[model samples]
Target: MQRVVSNLCNLLCSHYEITLISCYKANETLPATYNFPTNVKIIYFNEIYPDFKLDSFWDKVKFSYRINQLLPNGSKNILIVNNLLYPFFKKKNTIYIRLFHNSFENAYKKYLYKKPLFPPRIALFDKLIVLSSKELNHWQKLHKNIEVIPNFLPSIPKESSPLQSKIVLSVGRMDKGDQKGFFRLVDIWEIVQKDSRFGEWKLHIVGDGLLKEQIEEKIKAKNLQDSIILKPFTNQIEQEYLQASIYAMTSLFEGLPMVLVESASFGLPQISFDINTGPSDIIENEKSGFLIPDGDLEGYAEKLKALMQNQNLRESMGKRAKEIAQEKFSKEAILLKWQKMFNN
Candidate 1:
């Protein structure tokens, strides 16, 4: 929502009154501050509690009730619901557009290990928007109104440095609490650190996670303390992309990661394990990036080495990546597609 909504505001700032409504109030300032016009109104609907986790029954009930009652009932309100909130209320002539950020079946299987709670609500959605072509295919097997609308990152800053560091970076929620693919990333990183060839290169992880302690333990056990640097989250991730040469991910799955888009915008080619559908769509193997065969740690390590050893290949691919990003994924270009959706 950040990419599309923010870009939408940018595109129609002068013509439309874009109000950004947050379900739960945030204590800290909005991340990556908005450049909204004076016409835009940002407001919070539900009270934010510090201890509310979605897994709790009481929290879920309270949230559902609050959401069901609080949505703006104004005739002009276009209730663009994110995937998780689609099952809750009803609105008429509200342009009930649903944005599916992740693959539904994959996420439900990974998180719930059960079927969706509100199957009927899924059927009632007027339209579904997803980031990758693969996700459109996945959903279209059951629904016809699904559309592909890829997310875009703003252009890299003028002062951003060229891809110079040999460091391989992966950005995602490090919380081992979810059990999604945190361990798999740590395992692959350990394998990458064992070779002396990567001695000159660093494995810098930038994100906070519940599994920080466990991730640290694995690094210490492999005596990769010096080789691997676990840094906390930073709002200025563009700098991380600027210094890094390669973006690596071992996610078991995704809905086309924003980090990969951000990384590629600066010509930092990716090396990711084949997930259910996102990485393969973004990373063109041996062209702009390499997609390691799924669950192949040894192959991932070797691919990383090949990119690291040959600086020319890395630079060439990074340059090609920047071209692809500029031509296909800029916010200005992608915003046109969204405008067309709104028009339809």
Candidate 2:
């Protein structure tokens, strides 16, 4: 989410007057990760409504009222949300856009159908942006104004970094239980560790969340403390990607995981479960990497073991992955898509 927002801010800042509004309080300690252009302005919801609690229905109403008051009362202004479906502002001048970062099935379950078939207020929006062609078709059934714009690779070294560490990398927030399928990776790692060919390789899990303690306990119970390393989130995450030999994801579902795109750009062979949406769009199965069936832990381990044992195969796949990322997901391509969307 940070990568997508930062990338847009960086790309559009020079061309447009961008104002970023966050729904939460700004972190005081950490400096801005992305260098925002001089024209970009950032505002936090907490700064505007300091006592507003997002969990409270009344507070949300008050926040919406406050937002309506602040925004210009004309159609010239554009309001883009990550995925949240807000109530219609009723002002004719403000255009509302919902940029979906997950599957339409999930978004429908979240916003449209609470009970029976409640009509979504989505008609209020001027446009909708989806991550894949599959999502575009699904959402087209519901609305006419939609476009497919895949996520782009963030700035990373184009050359393949020397694989100095025998490490398998997986990154995501641990708090998302079934969505991330992080616990499933712990089980898969245990199976991989049992194989002598992969005994020397270590699994590095990155990011922290509410489930961190539970994941730590599971690692201890499985006696994978040495083999499986859990690290907190870091700004220097690109270095972690460069050091690792392969990338792995066990997500149950995704829109289009930016991490996979970023990892592939660094020339890392990726192994991820073939879930509903994201991985299949990025990985060329058995070419750039392997995309095993969703929830097939044994198959995932076997493919991962194959990559671990064959250095030549890993390098070949990594090189192809880098080429695909560079050719298809360059910043220039993505920026053009967004510029067209805004202009249209």
Candidate 3:
């Protein structure tokens, strides 16, 4: 969420005066990670409602009401909301643009179906933004105003990462193990490690989460401590990408995954499950990477093993991956799309 906001702010700030409004507290400890333009102004809702609990329903309602009151009563001001909470603020004069960062199915569950309060409020928005054509199609069935704009690679690597190590990399927050399918990856790694063809290759899982201890336990139980490395989140993630030969994702579902885009920019051949939205959008099957059938652990292991054994195939796919990422998801191309949207 921060990446999308920061990237858009960085791109659009030159032409417009941008004000970023947040519902959370801005303290010294939780400093701004992104470098915002000098023209951009950031406003935190906690200043008005200091006791706001992000998880509490009543607090969210109060926050929404405050936000609605804060917005200028004129169409000249454009409001782009990158969260489900946009439905709560039904301002009359402003242009409300919703930037949905999840698959339509997930969005349906999170914003519309589960929370009955949102469907009617959803109609209040002027435009809805989706990540893929699949999501756009799905959302169009329910709403009239929608657009498809994919997430872009923030910056392409200057040169492709050399495939020197036999490493298969997977990155995501481990706290929500079910969502990211981290447990599933551990099981898949067990199968991959057992295969003689991939004996030397290691599975490197990156990012921290609530299930860190449980994940560690599973790795130890399987005696995969040596073969499977669990790494804490790091700012120097690009270095990790450069050292890896292959990228893997077992996510049950996703918004258009930024990790896949970053990995592809490094020219790493990817192998991911054919989830609802993301992997298919990024990877070209058997070209840039392999897309295994969803929940097909055996197939995933086999594909991983095949890639690990064949250096030539990995190199060829990695080259294609870099080319596709650069051509399709360049920052300039994506920024232009946003610029057009803003103009419209």
- CA lDDT, every model vs. true structure: 0.71, 0.81, 0.83
Measured with C-alpha atoms, the lDDT of residue 142 in candidate 1 is 47
lDDT of 3 by residue, 1-344 (tens): 77677777887787777888877754453326676666888888777677766577876667667777877665467888876365466677568888888787875756565678666666767898888877866777557988788888767988777887988899999865367898999999999888776778888999898999999999999999999999999999998999999999999989899899899999999999998898888899999999999999999989988888888989999998988888878878887787788778
Candidate 2 whole-model C-alpha lDDT, 0 to 1: 0.81
Could you give the C-alpha RMSD of every candidate to the true structure, in order shown?
4.4, 3.3, 2.8
Cα lDDT of model 2 by residue, 168-265, tens digit:
99998987555788899999999999887777899999999999999999999999999999999998988899899999999888888888888999
Best by lDDT: 3
For model 1, residues 303-327, the per-residue Cα lDDT tens digits are 9888888878888888777777777
Error of 2 at 161 (Å): 2.7
Question: Which 10 consecutive positions of candidate 2 have the poorest summed lDDT?
Answer: 111-120
- Runs in model 2 deviating more than 4 A are 22-34, 43-75, 83-94, 115-118, 176-178
Q: Model 1, residue 116: displacement in angstroms?
A: 7.0
Measure candidate 1: CA RMSD. Answer: 4.4
Off by over 4 Å in 3: 29-31, 48-69, 72-75, 84-93, 110-112
Sort every candidate by TM-score, greatest first. Answer: 3, 2, 1
For residue 149, give model 3's deviation from the true position in Å. Answer: 1.8
